[model samples]
Target chain A: MTTAAEFQIEYLQYLQADGKAKSDLPSFASDETLMVNLYKTMVQVRAYDTKAIALQRTGKMGTYASTLGQEALSAATGAAMQKDDVFAPYYRDYAAQIQRSVSMLEIYQYWGGDERGNCYQNNPHDFPMSVPIGSQCLHAAGAAFAFKYRKQNRVAVTTIGEGGTSEGDFYEALNVAGAWKLPVVFVVNNNQWAISVPRGSQTACETIAQKAIAAGFEGIQIDGNDIIACRKIIGDAIDKARRGDGPTLVEAITYRLCDHTTADDASRYREDNEVTNAQELEPIKRTRAYLTDVGFWNDEKEAALQVECKKNVDAVVEQYLNIEQQPLENLFDYHYAELPANLVEQRQEVIEGSL
Target chain B: MNELTLVDAVNQAIAHELASDPDVVVFGEDVGKNGGVFRATANLQDRFGENRVFDTPLAESMIAGLSIGMSTQGLKPVAEFQFLGFIYPAFNQIVNHAARMRNRTRGRLHCPIVFRAPFGGGIHAPEHHSESTEALFAHIPGLRVVIPSSPVRAYGLLLAAIRNPDPVIFLEPKRIYRLVKQDVPDNGEALPLDACFVLREGSDVTLVSWGAMMHETLQAANQLSEQGIQADVIDVATIKPLDIDTILNSVEKTGRCVIVHEAARSFGVGAEIAAQIGEKALFSLHAPVQRVTGFDITMPYFKLEKHYMPSVEKIIAAVNHTMEF
Candidate 1:
């Protein structure tokens, strides 16, 4: 036998599940202000997610995907990205969208069934929430191709669930990104369960990160619950991509603590004890624990943060509810640059209540 | 002015846009150095650099998804699928994303892309290479499906499709790609979309068809003219936002109609035209609308393709049937 090539997946972590450090922390941990901001953002995301689910339960919104145990992944990715860089996010990356200036009111309006919610007033370049699995990966790569073609130092970042790796579109995106040496970063949120299907059943591979190696690139695994590690590892990948060193795949290992969405009942297929055990290792708890142990956070500070997040979430809900329904013509207007003659007649009929 | 075939006109139009618009990009399997399988994009990568015209990995979904992304970023991406039969993999991206991008975002972003592919059956080729599934795209609300039958129309409509501020499904008829030649001017003039071309005017019957089927339809029109039954031949260049007004006017004048297509008869673009004529022009139509189309089955392989595809004889028979009725 002759040796050809060998590769190893590198694992990264800073904070353990029990308010302890696994090793020396990354350089960013020394910045107390940044760490506090990261914690605050994660808290806000959890609050927003909770309110969204409540609204869905109360018949105020449509089916909502809650990012209950994955706030650290969203917050860290958002923090690492620059304003000019585009973020192609999947449905559960609300924290990252908020960081990019997509308001909570807009998110509410989206789940409430309004197209105007996608027309971001501030963040014009970022893509809307991609509900289709693994499709956004190619869009990110295409955006990266445009950036590289224009000779701009910008990176395109995208997130997908671990189960999405099975999609052909996902592999196609990775292969093209590798072949073209495009500046894109793929972050796989290995949240253990894709709806009712667990990770073990989703793929036979030992790790999702190693899938990138097949595309001729480096793939790394990270402890997604650790806020410090999430930010550091994803930030490093983004920086490398921006420098035109080609694409990287980061597989963040986390767990989905809630049902897949407001429509799902996880208890039907999941054990209560397993859920209880996973909750102990959830993202927000460990980050909060780490902050408390380091003296950066206390009971008083935590209580204040919770209140602030609630007030913010409530205000956005009010705004979302107060917005008026878009005119029926809006449905026909944006389908083309200018409505074609056929659509014009259709729109008129709609307005006249004859359609 | 230069004599050009339909495929030649396609190449000319793409090359003209690549030269004029810096944001225009061309990519697909075998499109770069090979100039496409049909040579529809011949010499483009050489004329423009690799960045402007390039080849992509053989993934239809990626080609479509990439075009959506590039188009959102202000790049006019003209992507090609090797064949219309091979475009099923990208159907989700096209229908869900490319078609809905502008509407979903409320005009915050839109995909100004041209998805081109060689379509329809005639020349002997393998299975999955000859498909005239234009109706599948024409049925999509946000897409503009345009097919060209002649060199002049091909050159002009392609320019229009590339410049349209929305996504267009540009299906080239491989059957008639080199069957005819015409003097096509190199001027970057774009014909108007959402309109039909009146190839010949008559007062006996209106004949409607597009793509390669237009060849047989035109031949049928000529044969009908020789028989002293003046027929109005209408080329429905853009089938999606159909120019029903022109068809209605022609049918009202002629008082009879016969629609032709190479796709399956059931629920085809031909069916849509017949339904519209029934709804709005029923009073004007002297006889029932007749359709000459392929049977509702898989497009047979080369040995049986001629029997499956609509023929000039079949179109003439349809016209005679409409006239006799």
Candidate 2:
């Protein structure tokens, strides 16, 4: 008998839970600006998440999905990509969207029931934050297909939760990306829970990254809580994609330290002990501890960073609150390039009827 | 000018668009080396090369999402579903994403993709192959559903759909894909969308139909003309954002109206036409609008497809009933 297929799923963990690296650090870890920038971005995203939850509690915004513990995943993935590369991100990727130049104010506007929130000015290639689970994965593949067809040296990166990986769109996208050899990367934030359902119930596969193996691509797992591992692994995958080496599936193992959304009460399904343990392994605290251990950050810098992040978030919130309600005609206007005659009458009807 | 069937005209139009625009791409199942299932994209991959015209994985949802993504990035992707019934898997991408992309993005990004599917019965295809679900697409706020009843219209309307800035669901009548032949010039002239073409002039009753059903409708009109009951015939090419002005004008001239369609009667496109006629042209002093349509049931297999479809007799009877009133 001959062994036909042999496969292995690689796992990466650079920084352990206590903020200690098990081995020698990559060269990029020594770059002071990059290290501090990652830490600061995680802090900013955390502050933004707290403020968004507050706004939702006060009835100022819609129910928001929080990236409370998965900050390193977004920071690393967003920072790794080139400017021209497109990002088809899911709703929980607020940190990544901000990195792509989708302003925090715009994200605020979106959660506050405004369409203009998705209108990106700086990074025009990035798609609006997709709310319908795993649908953006296919969009990423299509964008990659366009790049490959046009011979453009660019890659498309999409982020999704472990729950999104279960959706049929995820597999279909990966299948196409693999078969076509498109320049795309799928970053699965394997946060242990998909609403009330835990990761155990999501799939029978040992690791979500292994799901990519059946699709004919390299699949790898990484310590999503460790910024160094995230940055290095995702940056390497992106470079490979940009070099036309085909797609990669990256399952960043992390935990959701918050409720699924502001609307969810995770305590009903998840035990307090589990949440407590996961909190100890949270991305922001681990990165902060790593910075402290290296003497690159101190108590004074940590306090000042917190205050700065709060100030920045508050400024964006103020800007978001000042925006007036969009006109009613805006609803019908953007539906088509040129409003047809029937819609013209319909728009007038809406105006007259409102009065 | 070459005389071609509706399917051949569809191929010609795709070839023209791919030749004229560097950004236009055509992809679907078996659309490349095997051509399309219906051959609507025959010889396209060979003509435009594999990059411009290609085959996609058998996943319809991915095909739709891919088109939406490509369209946002300045490519005009004309994706074909092997058949209309297969499009249900992709309905989410069509209705939720592609249709709403422009509105959700506040016009900053728009999908200019054309989703083509061969629809309607009478082709003797296997189960789940024949369907006429245009009304579902027409009801979507941002989607434009256009169906062509003839070769000339197929060539022109397909070109127009490829050129339109918004997403269009171009439901080609597969039953008529090879049924009729007409002169379709290779000049790349696109006909206007959201307009109706008055096929015949009459004074008594107006007959409205679209897609493959137009054959029975026009036949009935000609037969009705022989009986001294002159019937005005209109082919509603664009089902959504309909040319109500033309339909109303024809209705006003001919006080009686009969809407013909092959889709189910309940909440079908015929119902919309009837409701609009009652709303605007009600006082024209004629009979209540009559609808000659298919029954509300799953489109049955080939054996009973004829019984499910509207026939010339059914349309003529409706016209006669309206004229007598």
Ten residues in sequence with the least summed lDDT for candidate 2 chain A: A3-12
DockQ of each: 0.88, 0.85
Question: What fraction of the true Cα-Cα contacts (under 8 Å, chains A to B) does candidate 2 also have?
Answer: 0.80
**Poorest 10 consecutive residues of model 1 chain B by lDDT?**
B316-325
**TM, every model:** 0.99, 0.99
lDDT of each: 0.93, 0.91
CA shift at A51, candidate 1, in angstroms?
Answer: 0.9
Off by over 4 Å in 1: A1-4
True-vs-predicted CA distance for residue A346, candidate 2, Å: 1.5
In model 1, state the lDDT of residue A34: 91
Per-residue accuracy of model 1 over B4-121 as CA lDDT, tens digit each: 9999999999999999999999999999999999999899998898989999999999999999989999999999999999999999899999999999999999999999999888
Candidate 2 chain B has its poorest 10 consecutive residues by lDDT at B316-325
The alpha-carbon lDDT assigned to residue A146 of candidate 1 equals 94
lDDT for each residue of candidate 1 in A217-329, tens digit (9 for 90 to 100) = 98999999888889999999999999999999999999999899999999999899999999989988888888888889999999999999999999998888789989999
